[model samples]
Target: MNKRLLSTSFLAIVACLLWATPFAAIKIGLKYTTPLNFAGIRFFISGLLILPFIPKFKAKLRGLSSKSWKLIIQVALLQTTFLYGLFYTGIDYLPGALGAMLIGAQPLFAAILAHLMMKNDKMTWTKISAILLGMLGVCIISLGRADFVLTTTIPLGVGILILNNIVGSMGNVIVARDTQEIPPRILASFSMILGGIMLILVSIPLEQPNWTIHPSEYYFALGWLAIVSAMAITIWFGLLGRKGVKVSNLNTWKFIIPIFGACISWLILPNESPDFISILGMLVIAFSLLMLNYFNKKRIKQ
Candidate 1:
């Protein structure tokens, strides 16, 4: 691969890994704080932390049209504030395995949204099969952990998570569009900061959260997550904006998150063990990824 592709791959892989392990932190942080407010505090601090370092970021903001600002705000609303709000709240009420399964649905939604919105990313049967395999692998992995309970009953939590996936997917599609107007870093910073403010606004009336109740570990988790968010968000925006990149292709890498989540859970939490079934699920996920990326690329060469 070319250097640019190599760099993007490295960044994308690491970013997904970072994104993968954070659900534990969010779950832990929620024990001491309300979901919405905790998310707001974490993302708001993330935006603050990211904004100052890039001096060139401000120069890129000049002369942006009103429409561009609107687009950025829409991204912020859907991607950060609304998406995370539903996510944190929904996960709070569901079993962890089920929640992971639902969250794993995001790439499917993203791929569908990309197919609908971006002509260049039209779906093929191969991509569809890959999506299914990846999702099934996730289900198997979660099931191995005793967290996967298939049910048709749509509870409030499931409803919220469904909406969360849709909104998050749409936001990703929006980001993937080639507007060529806003710089990626500036866009990332604005959406995060603004969306975070919106989350805080909602939290005040609905959650009225107590920020002071948590011990030092809570803050440590929150801080680590904030830093990860800063890195991941910026890298994602950069990747999405890169020429010739597809939203679906990048989102598929998110399947790796479950592998990390399962492993990390076994390490961090008591009673969680690495079982043979989960290991099998991990292998299936790897094969699915190879079919999606490697074989797909090789097919083009033929």
Candidate 2:
């Protein structure tokens, strides 16, 4: 492979693997905390952790333009609040692999949204085919198992996760426009801080907001997730701002996440294992990403 391709692949792998970790971690955390409360505290702490990296944190805050502030809040509400409000809750009812797999479809959604919203990134036939393959991959996963019986919770969980990804896709579009205008770290910090606060407020009413952790696993989850949020968002947004990377191209890396999530879940969580059908489905999902990203790129270059 070319050196640049190798480097890009490495970065994408690292970022996606980091993201993949949170599904199982959240599952562990939710045992001791409600979904909302767990998500709220994790993001809030992560946001705070981002402050020391800023050149002049306090001065930057004071100097922020009103437009910057508004963008920050808008990102907070759309990216963090609305997206995660569904995600953390939805993941609760899903198998770790399944949930992560669904979220991995995000690029497909983003591609469609970007084509509709951004003039340059039009929906090519290749992209449309890629989107259908991705959706089919999701369906295969959802429809897996000869014994797979549908339940209210499972269906509801799927619905919530789908909604979560849609909101997240929209966030990507919004963030992509202003990515160069604002620092990724600053945006990650404030948006997370504000969104975390919003989630915490919602948790107080819905989940009573568990303030303590007894299980060591809950602490692991919280700490890991916080770190993931801080690091991943910073890197992810920074990547999105790169001159040639489209939202879909950058997001193709997301396919690796479900693979990591499933493997970790199977290894650590005794209760979850991938069936043959699900394994097949996951392969399909992974291939769809290749179709959208790798092959598409090759064709464009050719």
Candidate 3:
């Protein structure tokens, strides 16, 4: 493989690994800190980590048109603030594995949104089938859990999580379509900084001034979220720029995140194993990802 392809593949794998660990780490960390606080800290750390690299970011912010700024703001809100806020809050209520599984439906949402919003992108039967399969898988996983029966309260949490996925997927499509005009590195860095600021402002009212690091485990979890999850996303955007959005979508292999999180939860945390239906759901999601790749390739050839 060429160097670009090799680097792209490696970055994709790294993104997946970092993403998978977030659920487990968050689950552990939530034991000590509030979701809002955790998210704020994660973003802060991520911002600090990337500060040194800011000089390398090539986008000419001053020269950007108002339209571009609008696009960037929209993306930051949908992809960063709304999605991450809802996701972290949902994680407070659900297991890390389940949260990941639910978010795995994002690509399906992206496919749909892309077809609707982008004239160049059309939804094929193959894409539809893959999406359906993934959706079914999520249903199976949810249904199989003995406690999965509809509780009015849990549904609220799940609904928020689902919304997070939808917004995130839409953001991805928007970013992909717009990358021709906006440099991904500039977009990613600015979005992170803006999103971090937003999260901190929001958290000020929601979270107390308890900046206490009560446990060493909390510190570890924060470190992982900051260095791994947040920074990994920045790296992901860079890869997306180099590889193209469709190729970057292949990073959904990070769907393995929930599976890995689930396994760790079962082994290390006091989390329960998913039922047979949940296992089926995971398989369905995996199959859907394969179909997405297949159809995406077929469309390119046509």
Candidate 4:
């Protein structure tokens, strides 16, 4: 394999692991602060941290068309506002691992949306089957208990999270196609700043009047999100730049994030243990991801 491809693959794996832990972090942080406030502070810190680095980042943004800027805004809204908001809120009701699994459906949504929206991308039966298997896995994991119907709120939250994933997948397609002309670093930085600003503005009305971080644990969570999550995004886009968006989509292995998130939840929160069906669901998800990678590789070769 090429050195760049190898390095990008490694980075993608690391990013997935870092992201997986975020649900636990968010769950912990929520104890100290409201979701909107927590998300706002984290984004602000991340946006500011990248400021100095932004000047050194290189990618062509000299003559972006108005259409491109509009697309970037759309990407920011989908990724930052709708997606993150739903995710954070969902974590309040569901285990992080479960949340991750729910969001794991992104690649499936991406494949479907890409087929409809993009000219180059097409949906194949293999992709459709992979999506179906993945969705079945998620259902097994998420709703396979005798008291399954008892977790009504969780399903609602997961529904929003799924929508978040769909929007994110759509944004990924946009970034993949458009960012080819723009610099990844520049685009990442700008998107973060824009998204951060939007969150701050949104939080003004939706969040508590006097925001405060209660426990010191909140700070740790914030730090984890700012450094790990934000940095991973930068790294993700960088990898995307070197490889195409399709190649970068492989980063969805971070889908295991929900699994890690759920494990942490079982330890820290009052979450129930996974039943056999849920465990089976988890296996199905893993298998689906493996198949996705295999099919993606085969498609590339063909």
RMSD of each: 2.4, 3.4, 3.8, 4.1
TM-score, candidate number 1: 0.92
In terms of lDDT, the best-performing candidate is 1
Residues 126-194, model 2: lDDT tens digits: 777766676666556555522344566888888999888889988888888764677778998999999
Candidate 4 at 95: error in angstroms?
A: 8.9
Q: Candidate 3 lDDT, tens digit per residue, 1-302?
A: 67765565566766776776676687788788667766766776776677566664544666678888888788778777788899877755665446545776676667667778767556667756766676666556645553433444577777888888778877877776776576665677667667777877788788763666478888887887888845677777766555345522443455555555455566666557656766776787778777777766776799
- State how far residue 15 of model 2 sits from its true place (Å): 1.7
TM-score against truth, every candidate: 0.92, 0.84, 0.79, 0.78
Q: Say which candidate scores most in TM-score.
A: 1
Clashes (backbone N, CA, C under 3 Å), per candidate, total 0, 0, 2, 6
lDDT tens digits, residues 38-142, model 4? 776787677667657755343345566777677667767876777777776776576644764566677677777777777766777776776677777766755
**Candidate 3 lDDT (Cα, whole model)?**
0.68
Off by over 4 Å in 4: 1-8, 54-71, 89-102, 143-159, 242-244, 247-254, 262-279
For model 1, what is the error of residue 174's alpha carbon versus the real structure, in angstroms, after optimal superposition?
0.5
When summed lDDT is taken over every stretch of 10 residues in candidate 4, the lowest stretch is 141-150
Clash pairs, candidate 1, are none
Question: Which pairs of residues have clashing backbones in candidate 2?
Answer: none
3 against 4, candidate with superior TM-score: 3
